[model samples]
Target: METPSSDASAPSPWADAERIVLGRDARGGAVAVALDRGGEHGRRPLSSTELPVWVSAREAEGAATGRGIRWVWSSTAAWYSALLGAGVRVSRAHDLRLCHAVLRDAVPSASALREATAWDGAPAEAGPSAGALFELDDLSGNGAAGSRRPGRDGVAETVAELLRQDAAVAQAAHPGRMRLLLAAESAGALAAAEMRAAGVPWDAEHHDRILRDALGDRRAGGAPARMTRLAAEVREALGDPALSIDSPPRLLRALQRAGIRVESTSKWELGEIEHPAIAPLLEYKRLARLLTANGWAWLDEWVRDGRFRPVYIPGGVVTGRWASSGGGALQLPRQLRGALRADPGWRIVAADVAQLEPRVLAAMARDERMAEAARGRDLYEGIVAAGAVRTRAEAKIAVLGAMYGATTGDSGRLVPRLRRVFPDAMALVDAAARTGEEGGVVTTWLGRTSPPPDDAWRAAQARASRSGASPADETRALRIGRDRGRFTRNYVVQGTAAEWALAWLADVRLRLTRLAPVDSGEGAPRSGPAFARRAHLAFFLHDEVIVHAPAEHADAAAEALREAAEAAGRLLFGAFPIDFPLDLRISDSAAKD
Candidate 1:
């Protein structure tokens, strides 16, 4: 923070800085203030050009490596994207927007920090580059990118909110745990932005080939060849050549006319009925979904210059799971994984933790029995070996039943046996379900609380308990309660699993940053200069990560994934005996050798 100035004896403000808050100054330009361990440093003008250079120098000097200057921003989604585009990678950040949402519900002490601020809303998308836009044209006041990004807080407001959040964390019941959750959530925001900038290494050609193989040729303004044939077959079987097979109501009526006697055209329901139309109808739905979701048009829109830049919305889900606004990053089908091809001299190190939620559940419940069952192997198989179930299939159903609050059929039958064996784990979810049934709240392992029952739900319960309530009213109330119970039963586990995933992602990001950058041409230039030559995380689903790296660094990246998983486990659930085993491999493409 110090320039070549009068006092030669003094040390630089950023030498041992705690954090840096980025916000708009009164002059409508960007300002950065360094927070020293002692107190706040004075505000200084930071332009789009100088900010990255100073940050790059700090990184080069290795000052921000450990417990370093965490960049405090109004919204990471609005800010970090441009930073990545500018080739400046920030090591750590405190995303006020994301943290505000987490605290407003989870930490009761932090409720005053709520008060419906702009930070509570969905984050603004990353706008045009500041260096290119604002630096060239002073259209908006702030010199930073996304100066016109709606709902952004200015310098004074940003610092005030940060202080409020810090105080909220300080007053929380478990301050350390609250702080860890905030850090993890913020790290997730940063990673999401960076991943968008980096994008998934994609091969447009392979994507096209896969599309053609499954959907046939890309017919202009019409259904693909395969889809057309299937639609015709479906129409012929229904004895209605003009039937709109895509229209569910019309298709249902047509099936009824053909004497199928089915309530719905769902594959599951239709598969139960033996009919000529069933086979072709099911095939049509499958291909149509694929074609609509990831067909030729998808390739044209998403894939660009060997990368598929999906817009990632971190913390988008109520359970804290990430949702994709664009390229379906969370739902990339296994069929198109072959399109995830690395560059010529680089490779893909893909690793997904096996049964992450169950493992997290065991740790949360501290269920030694379940932990022992999962020691160094598949939990379902371990259940069978432990004599709790006859087969892995039974174990899976029972475990899923426990988490999802299943109450009938095979799941209901098998759940009791699991409850008897792993009482602690089952009890944890069962209590959460009961809380949900009574309109109470349940919290994740790291303290993310489930949202309370809505007013409609509360009204239904109240009505059902009233003196004038009838059997139908009570039945409706009970059904809704059960639905909520099911939701909360899964929420605690899913949310905590998300927390674990965030920790994993943050750790992997840091580890990847520390690795040696390779000497190569601009292989994935869209990844930005900061990451173009180094091993970088290219894709992330909830429990899986794919790191694109140099061939020589593939082993190192794989090792980082393993180490990061273990580190994340300990970071969240210290001294827990649970382990996160990964089904990992290194390859040129997502295709099998």
Candidate 2:
């Protein structure tokens, strides 16, 4: 339902599906047919219907030059869109012939798909749905409610408390700690307040119940459960009532000393290996060293006004994203969230997006079966219902590969079944794969296109295609061309998915802006609170986001998350047969290890 635009002036097929059945074949390129409604001036499907056509710039120019329209430039789907939009009456009688004609011609030479000495046609294993080709607005935070005034020395109080708290000191040693934490806290508070201000209908208890239901299967025997146990141990070791967790080094050290071997593997790729304690350990330590030596001093100087406000980078990732500053907020070390603490009067409300990418994939593919599989329960289990090969792990592997481009082992074996069950989604990604391997430019749903292929590669393709080359030699050159094509093919979907994320973030920010502040009056500053206390988006890594808030508005923030998901769905795909849902979790800390 999230339709990509062929041209800015043209409406999307889904948006105009009622008017026509858009379609194409290789020969005629893009084509459309008007729908026939019962009664009235009905135009029945006719092979000889005089269809008036409008062509793109190239096609128009070709007509003027007396050269037949090439048809190779447009895709079958794109052509089909043209047909539907053109108002031709189409039916089953003409489906296959019309479709084949458009597709056969548009299909590149066999060289585009076959592997050869010069190159390969096969698409690279997909990456987690990522690529960028869309516009995204920045996250907003313009100070606390009713006034643009900065909060009184509240940042100082929080920082001071952080300084006194030994565990906080260890974690805050990282650069941008104060700023990032403050931003997160501010965002959370603002979300809570916004619900009160707007008087939106929300059920905090129901939200909590949903989260619990979602998490029920999470604790089943798995790496996740082990990680939880490790976390509890770290909290106990820290001996801080505040439950502050330092970044990775401290956590890793604690786990290592306790003799817990933390292992990780990239399931999508074969031979992907990680030592039990090395990879994540090194990652955590590297950040700690950088932040400790460089970021803290800068934070101290920047927050002189009692406010350590940081910019919120909305949709920063190849996908829709948001990032933060001052605290290296976006680069939060896993297991380090407990380091975030509020002042005496305030409590933390932390929330994150769950199963976001998969859900989006389901809706975008228009896989009602998959959507229903995800309905009312865990999406992983939904895959099980969809008939993924054995175990939840296998199901997860297949679903992820389908999104990211894993084409080996279980992932490869599983992808076929997923495609069989979800052809629309499969076809969408397949088109992307085809486009990239062919070295064509890839674009997102909103028209953001990838940079064209490198000149050297293009030159090689030309050289290989020359009339002088032997058939064998020519095959090699075409293969190279196809590899480049695969890259672009994957690029389109990944990039557009990111765009969708950004749009969703922007919508959430706009809605949250209308909310009012929560007044606990418990720590209610008599002279006004410190910091530029706004509901701030503090962290983002790909699809996930972290928002900080005051305890009073935690429920409201949760509700806003649901609203944001719905609004985003409407914005991208419109109300459809399928519903796009977001998995959400709210806690007092930012821990997802």
Candidate 3:
């Protein structure tokens, strides 16, 4: 197996595996499969002293070529026992191949990889192989091999199947590369959208150059006239040729002229410019801007291709959460999704979680009534139905407050009633509040901790903790009181929500991997560009995700979005106490929300 050009110099982690296998068919094509552990199987180090190696073979001789190979990682569940049956060093190789297959089979859209640290303070695992350590079967497929057909809901089945095949191809070409490209494109797209939304002219070459530069690939001479012409042509075909550029200062001026305000913030060295879109354009540009400015281009370079591939950031967020990179996988910008157009003959069937936070709260609290209320209609309405409040408006306020710790008028007034109705949910909030009041820091679901109080704040807290008869004590008390209050309110809802998100992502990844490929009817391009399997849960925000789907699948990629969210719920909770829902959308026109 040839190491990718990018990984040639890096240490291979799969070297020590007992056996390695690549699943290929008679025609030498990849067959995606759903896997299940069925029973306790085995575990091993993600990689060995030798570099992780994977061989892609055609059918017939390929499967047997590397006999005595101790491990094999394929998308198909049939291989589970077959590899064991191979008698060679046939253990399942833990890496992007397996993880991607798992993710693809598990869900259509989003996937997650949990983080576990090794003793040396370095990621115990290398990349995908290092992160992929769990073994599970395909839950969506028929229990046995050669037993899957499009379900009654042909739409979903078709989409799932398409994803499976695409994923298999992606894994073979390069696990998790297509997605990286998409993530990068997504950033560019997002930036383009934001500029357009703010009425700023955008330049494609300039933007591409910006991205190239962002990745430390700045060209000495300016972009070529041919490149500029090509970009303009692309813009014209898309019906927006004159709007591309590379100057941030010029963009700022345009935005100012357009009556939009730009505010900049940074994490590490990444700069974030936030501004409100004109009411009509809000949805369209939100996501585009987010990706462009927030490391999307760099993510593309890191992963491969220009897709928004998912990067597995285990514990990326404080609360045991995972974040994605390229595709705005985490922070999906709802407005611009309509621009997520697909390739020829393909269409996106997008969906998303409805009231994800509330439902998670219901499950965490084990509040049966709340769960029942949430069973059917809008969650806010369900809150009303459960007597959590008198009306829809009140329910909305209460629920939002509960999750966000909003202590303003309506949110503050409704908190008490919410507490009274859902004790379990309230308990989390109460605990968080107490912690906050004491100046404790809160974390997200994945255990990514927030920075604690700085020296001055800590000192103030210390002073406030004592009996404050003096003026300084009084000042400290007030400061601590305000700080603690804010922390406590956000702690519980955010943390628990993050947990639900991680579980959701993990579940979706697993289930979609179990499904088979779509028939694609007749004459559909069997393969082309697609996202690499199990790349990484890179970038994330509240409820949205941007997966770097493979270019092969790019033409028909929107299906992944829908599949991921559905898988997320099923894998996390199944059809149970509550439902975790989502709204999935797609777009191709970057600036059109």
Model 3 vs. true fold: TM: 0.48
* TM-scores of all predicted structures: 0.93, 0.48, 0.48
- Residue-level lDDT tens digits of model 3 in 1-593: 23333332333333322333332222222222222223112222212222222222211123444432222232222222222122111111322222332233223343211111111121212222222222213334233222332112111222233344344435433334333222222222222221111121112333454444423343345443334444444334334335443444553454455544554211211123333322212322322354454433533443222223333334334333444433344453443333333333333333346777777767656677788888867888877777779999999888887766677798999988988888877786667666766667553322223445567766776676677457878687776666666664665456556555544444333333333344453211221111122111222345544332223343233454455555555544456667655555443323233
Local accuracy of candidate 2 as per-residue lDDT tens digits, 373-427 = 7777777787787775667888788877776677789888998988887787778
* Residue-level lDDT tens digits of model 1 in 1-593: 34433332234656556888777654446666677656566456666666666666655444534556688887787777766767888888998888988888877766557653555677667542232111123322334322233322567666766777887888776888889999999998888888888888899999999989998999999999999999999999889999998899999999999998989888889889888889989999999989888888888898888889899888889999999899887887889999999988889999999999999999999999999999999999999987889999999999999999999999999999998999999999999999999899888887888899998889999999999999999998999999999999999999999999999999999999888888766565656776788999888899998999988899999999999999999999999899999988999987644
lDDT score for candidate 3 against the true structure: 0.41
Q: Is candidate 1 or candidate 3 better by lDDT?
A: 1
Q: Each candidate: what lDDT?
A: 0.83, 0.42, 0.41
User: C-alpha displacement of 497 in model 3, angstroms?
Assistant: 2.5
lDDT of 3 at 139: 31
**lDDT sort, best first:** 1, 2, 3
Model 3 lDDT-worst window of ten: 112-121
